[model samples]
Target: MNEIRVFCPATIANISCGFDVLGVALDSVGDEMVVRKIPEKGIRITKLEGQDLPKETERNVAGVAGLTLLEASGYDGGFEIEIYKKIKAGSGIGSSAASSSGAVWAMNELLGRPFSKIDLVRFAMEGERLASAVAHADNVAPALYGGFTLVRSYDPLDVVSIPNPPELYATVIHPQIEVKTSDSRSVLRTKITLAQGIKQWGNVGGLIAGLFTNDYDLIGRSLEDHIVEPIRSILIPGFDNVKSEALNAGALGCGISGSGPSIFAFCKGETIAKKVSESMKEVYQDIGIDHDVHVSKINTNGVRAI
Candidate 1:
């Protein structure tokens, strides 16, 4: 395909229990991108909409990611990209990831699928690094692998796809505040106590097992974040109230999504997910903070062509 249009997905990373490791993609929310193979030698950003960001190939995340892929492929020609952003930047939900993943994915598709998903993920990280100063794969992995993914090891770049429970749903509330990934990441402590580490490990294991076994209660119990939430929760307003209300509304559990500002909750069914959304919406409304709420079934197919 010389020109391909694709639906790139938004992602919730760090999933409360698996800081810097776990992520899931949303089925209905994301960005749209069109990539065209050209006779030129380098990547170019032909269009960008819905967000105020740089258009330069080197400065833009998508452009950077596409360039990374091109550099590795030794392809004779380059690509032209158009990005239509639906996910807001600094919204704590994989804004940069959609563009980055979309670009590299489309590029790989046009080249007869020479690169693996893991390879595409590595290329996407270059864009993320430009956006957040960290080449982490939590968001990109799920954006490409779909549903839930765990960054098992970074040294060898191992990413494991976790089965999504059929009834599992996610509700996310994004207050009108912006929390840049770089800014949110700065507040994190470099070290954690042994007790904290053990708790985090067990919860991560529990979450993975819960999904595998379709145990909603175990999933709920495993949603605890003993390490990152304490330090980062202060960054978002109404976080405590939202989490409490979500739990009260019968949500499985609730906690910060990604870095901050957007909070996500897990529910067993769509009805509870919608109910949890309202509970979360009410908190921001009561706080007089403008917000957006979304309820989505987990996306099993990450990115796809239109």
Candidate 2:
């Protein structure tokens, strides 16, 4: 095939306790892109929709990811990419990962699928690094592979898909605010106390076990983040009120999605998910903060032809 179109779902990174090591895909919102082969021998971005973004191929996440794949696969031909972004940038919801993964996914189809899923993630991380200056795979891995993902290690780039409970639902609320990823990372402390570290590791272990054993209560109890959330939540308006309201509204757990301005909650069913969404929205509305809410099942399929 000389051309292909793909849709990549938005992802929630740092799922409360994971903090740069865990993520899950959300089915409701994402970005779409089309990649077509061209006569020129380089990657080019031909169109962009939804919001104004940088068009330079090297500067844009999609272009950087596509170029990385083309160079790695030794493809000499050029390709043009068109992006229709649905996920808002700086919303703490893997917006760049959707574009990056979607671009490489379409390019892979056009190139007859030369790269593996892991390689696609590696290439996508280049795009993420261009945007965030961090090569973490919590967002990219889940965006590329779908469902819940665990970045086991970054030294050798080990990523594995964790089992997902079928009945679990997600409610994501994106407030009308911008929180730059760089600033978010900058505000984080570089080290943690031994006591906090032990607690975090135990919670991480419990979360993994909860996913494996399908224990909803364990998952709820393990969704505590004592490190990143305490610092970053201060940046998001009404964060504490919204999280408390979500839990009171039947959400299992709630926390900041990725960095800030967007908050997500985990619920057991669609009805409760909707209720949690409304409760969270009420908090934002009462504060005069414009926001968008999405209630969805976890996306099992990540980037795919559409």
Candidate 3:
């Protein structure tokens, strides 16, 4: 293929209970990019739209991801990338992951699919590092692999796909506020007590089992975050009110999406999902924060040709 266009879905990293280990792909809200092969030898970002973003290849996540893929594949030919970013940066949703995954996904297609999904995720992590200064795979893995994902190990970059509950729906609300990712990471404690750690791990295990067994209540009960949410939710306006209302409105659970400013809840069905969305929005509206809300099923397809 001389050119390829790919759409990569947005992602929710941490997923409340899992912290940095788990993430899920959303059906809507993503970034699109087109990669066109050229005669010259290097990667170039020809266009960027939807948000004010760096156009430089090295500074841009999509460009850096595409470049990384090219280097790894030993491809010397030139390519130009055009990005249409629908996901907002610092929304706590995986905006950077969408760009990073979209670029490498399109690049792999242009090069006749040279890399595995896992390798593409690895390249995307490098792109993520450019944005967040941390080469974390929680968001990138789900953006590449779809559904729910577990970053079982980072030393070898091991990512495992977890089964998604068929009836599960996600409600996401992105408040129009700036919450720097660096600031989010800086507020986190380096360590947690053993009791807190144990509770978190137990919840993580329950969540995974719930997904596999289609146990909706187990999934709801397991959505507790004892470590990250308490510290990070303070950064988001109306976070506690939104989460409480969502749970009261039939959401299985709700918490900060990734870091802050974007909150997400999981519901058993579309009706409950919509209710959760409305409840979350009401809180934001009361706080006078401009926001965007999305209710969607789990994206089974992460990144795909358009």
> What are the TM-scores, per candidate, against the unseen true structure?
0.98, 0.98, 0.98
lDDT of 3 by residue, 109-214 (tens): 8888889999999999999999989989999999999999999999888999999889899999999999998899899999999999999999999999999999
lDDT tens digits, residue span 1-306, model 2: 888888889999999889989999989889888889997898888999997899999999999988889899888788999999999888889999999989888888887888899999999999999988876788899999999999989889899999878889999999998888888889999999999988899999998999888788899999999999999998898999999999999998999999877999999889999999999999988999899999989998899888
Q: Write one digit per residue (lDDT tens) for candidate 1, span 197-290.
A: 9999999999999999999999999999989998899989889999999999999988888887899999999999999999899888888999
Give residue 63's error in model 2 in angstroms: 0.4
Question: Candidate 2 — which pairs collide?
Answer: none
Clashing residue pairs in candidate 3 are none
lDDT of 2 at 67: 87
Native-referenced Cα lDDT, model 3: 0.91
Deviation in angstroms for 305 in model 3?
0.9
Off by over 4 Å in 1: none
What TM-score should be assigned to candidate 1? 0.98
Go through the candidates in order and give the C-alpha RMSD of each one to the true structure: 0.9, 1.0, 0.9
Q: Itemize residue pairs with steric clashes in candidate 1.
A: none
